[model samples]
Target: MAATEPAGSRHRNEAGPVGDQVRANLKFFRARQGISTTQLARLLEALGRPILATAITKIESGDRKVDVGDLVALALALRTTPNRMLLPDYGPSRGQADVALTPTVTVFPDLAWAWASGKQQLLAAEIALGHGEESPFEVLEEFRRNALTTAERQHADHTAVRAAEAVLSSIRGILDRIDNPVRYDVEDESRARHPDSAARLGPAPATPEGLRARLRSLIAEIDALIGDDSDG
Candidate 1:
């Protein structure tokens, strides 16, 4: 029989800083869902790893060492990605954390939800400033203004910051396309068919007689081409 790794050494990481982030996220998410330690343990057990309530308390209190397998299990039970549990760099870091507030973790779901909501608002703003609409430029200006206001002082969370950036980036693209339209030369069939004749005529005839002469010459040229084709 193979000897199993010691119980304490089974899943512990050499660098224990990862444990702090995981424990924090696990406690925070679990509390938000109003799940008791017993309930969480049962959920983890149901996910193919049996966990006892005491084990959960020890993990949260930093008494027990949490391993990679345990982190994956906890993340699954909490319905969040493992990165959210382990990575503390998901949000902007402000120097070193003090003892007052729990550091905010910018989970992926929150960012996704904020982006979807901002997209809907941007769509409405686009309709308000669409082509041929009254005061369309003003509408875009007002939208940009409101977004700036929100970005500057409205909120402090990472989701809020990312959402604001998304709106501004989208608005800038729309404005750029509007300002720089594609240009093309007007297609002139007369110029294409008879460049030499057009040059000789010198800027087209303004008078009725000149117009009639031009038309007659064009008709004669067409007739000659048709005659040659029939002969051939």
Candidate 2:
């Protein structure tokens, strides 16, 4: 591996408890299902935006910290848990901890669930910013004007748009990911997703273009409620 690679790429390095688990489980499923990164990314795209091969590589290698959202997506992707990824036998742990662990145990679903819930919170927050009257779109215009007039204050519309786009793209990506159907039990959908996300689970379109149209529709409804033509 190259020195430029992240900590996860180094073979000489030891994997902490969670990292080890992710590596093991991803390897297990990828080989078992014979799924390629392109296929997996397609699945991810179905779930939201397009994930690159490198992103998948970083994730599988435990280079990136697997948050709850990542774990949920991974589990949904490979059909396993965060704990199972860390180590095959790891059950859910007792509390929210950030530390080292023994190599023997993997990850717990509860821990993964906690992490996933955190991810959902973040998504919800981003969605909240973009939704209804909170149109980051409208906010951007005001902020930009203020920033330009104020000393050293940037309006941050770019930042806001990026954030909103991320939320929107992720929603699109989730749409792409689920279409492939790794292990989407109705039970899992109800248990694992936010109410809004769960509702969107049924009968997602086959293409991103179609999903974008629906997103536009949702945005239009928001536009009406806010009665503002300019979102940003």
Candidate 3:
């Protein structure tokens, strides 16, 4: 009788296209950032979850599997969003290629990307007709059941706007600190000296200008959604 392969070895032998895409993108992003495996491992450690350089190499080479936690950590360490790491890197022109989301599931790159980015839901017939192709009776009913009331939607819009504004404020604060470190240090010292006089601050912002642009885009998107719902 043949000897059994180790349980951990299953991923290496059974890895599919989705795994392949992830591995390729992992290597691509790491290289794009000019980060070595050792550097990436250190970054992950700084993020509070340590992954050895050898394991990272295995993950990149399709010899290891990446769990959800690792995926998030890798994305953070690489300064990218999780969806960007999960999706395939279609070239500049983004040629019409079918992306395999699962062993039995494949979709056009656009649909796959949209679904991954929370822009659209994956439907049974989407592979054939593309997203928002038709609103069938069941789908319409499902939407109706889960649809937000007008007041609720307006409240959500306001909440989103407020959140975006908060993030923008945080980003501006970070930029200010970077541009005027001496003044920021003095302010920090003052704040430390007088706890009661210190102003509360939001969480640290991600990727400064890029994040600001994304927040603007998200606010615009929320406005568009509200407009579309109102029209409907």
Q: Which candidate's TM-score is highest? A: 3
lDDT, candidates in the order shown: 0.57, 0.55, 0.70
Runs in model 1 lying further than 4 Å from the true structure: 1-15, 89-232
lDDT of 2 by residue, 1-232 (tens): 5458776766864556657657667767888999887788788677665567778888777775555666667777777665556544422233324323344322334334433433212223344456456455565454445434453233323444434454465464455356434423554556466767755754343335545655666565556656667656
lDDT of 3 at 103: 65
TM-score of 2: 0.32
Query: Any idea how many clashes model 1 has?
Result: 0
Query: What TM-score would each prediction reach against the true structure?
Result: 0.36, 0.32, 0.52
Cα lDDT, model 2, residue 42: 81
By lDDT rank, best first, the candidates go 3, 1, 2
Q: Who wins the lDDT comparison? A: 3
Query: For model 2, where is the 10-residue window of minimal lDDT?
Result: 114-123
TM-score of model number 1: 0.36
Report how far off residue 195 is in candidate 3 (Å): 71
What is the per-residue lDDT of model 1 for residues 1-232, given as tens digits with 9 covering 90 to 100?
A: 9989888877644335557767788789999999999999899989988789998998888888787788889889999877667654322222323221112222233232232333222333344446445465565455445544566434423443544454454444334334432211121355568899867755333334444555555555555545545566
How many collisions per candidate? 0, 31, 0
RMSD of 2: 17.0
